[model samples]
Target: MTPSNTHTRNTHLSKESEQSQINKAQARYRREASDAAAAFMQFWRKTKEESTVPTKYKELMQLAIVLVQHCRPCINLHTQICVQVGCTRAEILDAANIALAMGGGPVFEYIGYLMQALDEFDPPKEAT
Candidate 1:
């Protein structure tokens, strides 16, 4: 009796372990999230390094806004990067407004999604 009970417990545990492994394999990669984050990082690095542009930061912010409006994950990643590089909330909102003007109602709908993501990943408060 004791041996049978122990065998059943081990079998149950083994099945759970196998299921978890299968789930992980099934959910691996997630290309959209990975790709968007990579693209945002690459663009951010390039935009920051170039020296010829007039109002470089603003230009970068404008581009970031367009990227964000098109891609929600890109918006979250780039917005966080922008905040790291001294972008203010007002500036971000302004860039988003510019996107709204260019992309219209569909763009406006995405703003709420982008804002939700930004709020989720808000930068830490700087010391005064």
Candidate 2:
């Protein structure tokens, strides 16, 4: 296993750029399987859009799960979106800790990616 500090995101791309790639891939998939992709995205919206769940908490949960999954594009997209929806640094880190508890050492390395994402996305507002 790599050291805990190792980050696996593509070295040259910004987080937004990573998200762009994911979007492009999604577009391609949608074109390739238009019906299935649309249905899946509809389900995606049903789960991810909104309801009784607050956006901040929902995104925190997503961040934790994605961190454990070690999907760099997901981490990049969700981290920025987490900040945009007003997740505090502490809240984000706490969610990361939950992932760490389940994901162990491999997840620890991925937290390095989360930290950078938080830093980049976290604006200069007051953080909890």
Candidate 3:
């Protein structure tokens, strides 16, 4: 084969190898993400089931911690769970206020996001 043809073939092979590596990395990332989600779900269920604390209080505490940590997804999840566990809006708000006091300014900013999640998951009742 001509020298130019050999170089072109080598370049093409290198590109294919790079693409293969990228595909492998993406697959690994997806698998890790799935596994992490599954593990988290298992841990969440076990914690709720085994704890002596009532589920509502646990969810409230989780919401408070997530608010302080500024984890929007956790905030949403725990808020939804809090509602499902029969926690009143007032209770949730009180927990949020405590979080704000503990976390100060950063947690205060996230309160709006928490409210948005609450509205999405457990909107207020309309006036009769």
Candidate 4:
């Protein structure tokens, strides 16, 4: 079976794997095509990791952009990053709503994926 198929199949069994798919794919590509992958990763670091904007805001903007583009993996990746950078659910939804306003119905439909990803990566914290 294809790797993507395996990722989908394993989703119910391993949310951890789901979150790592992008990292795994990047590792495979770097191993298989070292020069090209290195260049792309260098570019990724410059744009994503070194942004003048705060990482939290950059991650939120990325989530909004990917939601509009209908990229499920990117949405999941950025959602996880946003939470890691300390975004609350309200902030995540606020970023997501920008996509809805810009892309309208299609984006509205896909917001479900954002919701699912949010739940997967950052479920609500239980109150003490």
Question: Best by TM-score, which number?
Answer: 2
Error of 2 at 45 (Å): 1.4
User: What is the C-alpha local distance difference test score of each model?
Assistant: 0.64, 0.82, 0.81, 0.82
**Better-scoring candidate (lDDT), 3 or 4:** 4
State the RMSD for candidate 1.
Answer: 13.0
Give the lowest summed-lDDT range of ten residues in model 3: 119-128
TM-scores for all candidates: the values are 0.52, 0.79, 0.65, 0.73
lDDT of 3 by residue, 1-128 (tens): 99998986896577468657766886787687988767876887798973689887988898999999998657867888888878878889999999999999999999987886677677333312
Global lDDT for candidate 4?
0.82
RMSD per prediction, one decimal?
A: 13.0, 5.3, 15.2, 6.1
Candidate 4 segments whose C-alpha is farther than 4 A from its true place = 1-11, 14-26, 123-128
Off by over 4 Å in 1: 1-44, 54-69, 123-128
Better candidate by TM-score, 1 or 3: 3
Between candidates 2 and 3, the one scoring higher on TM-score is 2
Judge candidate 1 at residue 102 and give its lDDT. Answer: 77
